[model samples]
Target: MALTQGIPNNIYGLHSAEEQFREKACSIIDADTGLQLHLAVTEAAMDMADVLRQFDTSDEDLKVAQILGMRTFNAFGASIKLTLSGYHQNSALILRDVMETVFLLDLFAGDRLLIERWRFADKKARMRDFSPVKVREALDARDGFTSKKRFEVYELFSELAGHPNMKSSWMMRPQRDGDAVIGPFMEATALEAVISEMGRLAVQVGEKLDHFFPANWDQCLPSRLAFTQLKLKWIKTFYAPAGGP
Candidate 1:
């Protein structure tokens, strides 16, 4: 989670803010906390990597796979880095990429569970903190798709999800896998970044609202959207291969 010093702006921070907006849009409570959701994502990722190595592919493909695998890992790490820096946009973008790319990979059913967990986390945040911010509304949802390759790679996960898992041994129960990834993957620095960013944005938005509007906008926003609805919407809008990064 320790990003190299002098890291730039927060892409993920903005993403997180968007997610909060979505949750507020629907008034849902996510089942997982930020820390818990983060751990679920990391643990599920490791589990997925273990499953992928079992396939016997060509050396060339394997090498490519290895690079992609590392990319997945690094994507998560980048999120942690953003979290530590308290950069909401950067951390949120990383988290969104991880979900759209690696977490959606269909290798392990655990990935599905993890995605649900993230939704749950956002939902929880929305419910606990209902303060609505004065958004620019200038953020074109289109701006999120700057990397076409990243978008294509994430879509592959949806394509793969069509195939069903046939083995019983691969199954994992939620309680049994509880928060295992938090300690290892959600580093202290990462946790600090996420909490700090969320808190900071809340303040910024609150001030903006107070400055522009006559009354509080807190009650108008919902906590979170339905998970399935949010996922499908994100897949269509942000994961377009033409503009994804």
Candidate 2:
């Protein structure tokens, strides 16, 4: 396998990354080696999108669930692509949003009245009730600590990339000594674990809507989860149960 060397940036010296891409008509930096390992991860997410788009439902509430499902998976897919595109911070930022929506989806699943509240919430009501902190707190309270430690992961991404602060500067800097540029730079493992969780949660939300749209989900998305577990086992060949990008 050909390994990435030096700064694996899309941007070249006078040519901007966009211009370089336009000239080449495709990515100049080859990521096929890393990409092949993630095909299952991409496919799992894609399958969920397929389910959300085509599944039939008579319930109006389920239709609403479908829309939110689409939003959740669309953002999930965007985060994955952003990571591949070499925008780790931007990817983290988007993944943070995915986590937030997944939490909301879980809450909506249990008591969809909350969804109505959320849908009709004024700006002030939203800030007061549906904020990330409030939402995580609610989930932790409801699930008896399913979200207790998960919130820590959400906080990590939020601090590192979601909000502008001193810590975020590290995102633009290289791991080794060097200058930095507004990136399109490589970070193959930046959010691997969180992204794995995002994939699971995206499908989890889909499962909640299974009552609305009947399909053979157990053998489909759930089985993929069983096999891959989204852990990217390829990194260690044995340490992780599955390969990840």
lDDT of each: 0.35, 0.61
* Pairs with backbone N, CA or C atoms under 3 Å apart (clashes), candidate 2: 232-242, 232-243, 232-244, 233-242, 233-243, 234-243
TM-score for each model = 0.27, 0.66
Off by over 4 Å in 1: 1-34, 47-58, 103-245
Give the lDDT of residue 215 in candidate 2. Answer: 54
Alpha carbon lDDT at 185, candidate 2:
61
Say what the RMSD of model 1 is: 23.7
Candidate 1 overall lDDT versus native: 0.35
For candidate 1, lDDT tens digit of each residue in 1-245? 66766634576565665455434322321432543433433434433333344445554434333444455556655654554433333455454444433322322122223323333456556334221110111111223434454445334332322223432111111133343221112233334344433332222222222221113334322211122233334335434689665
What TM-score would you give candidate 1 relative to the actual structure?
0.27
RMSD in Å for all candidates: 23.7, 8.9
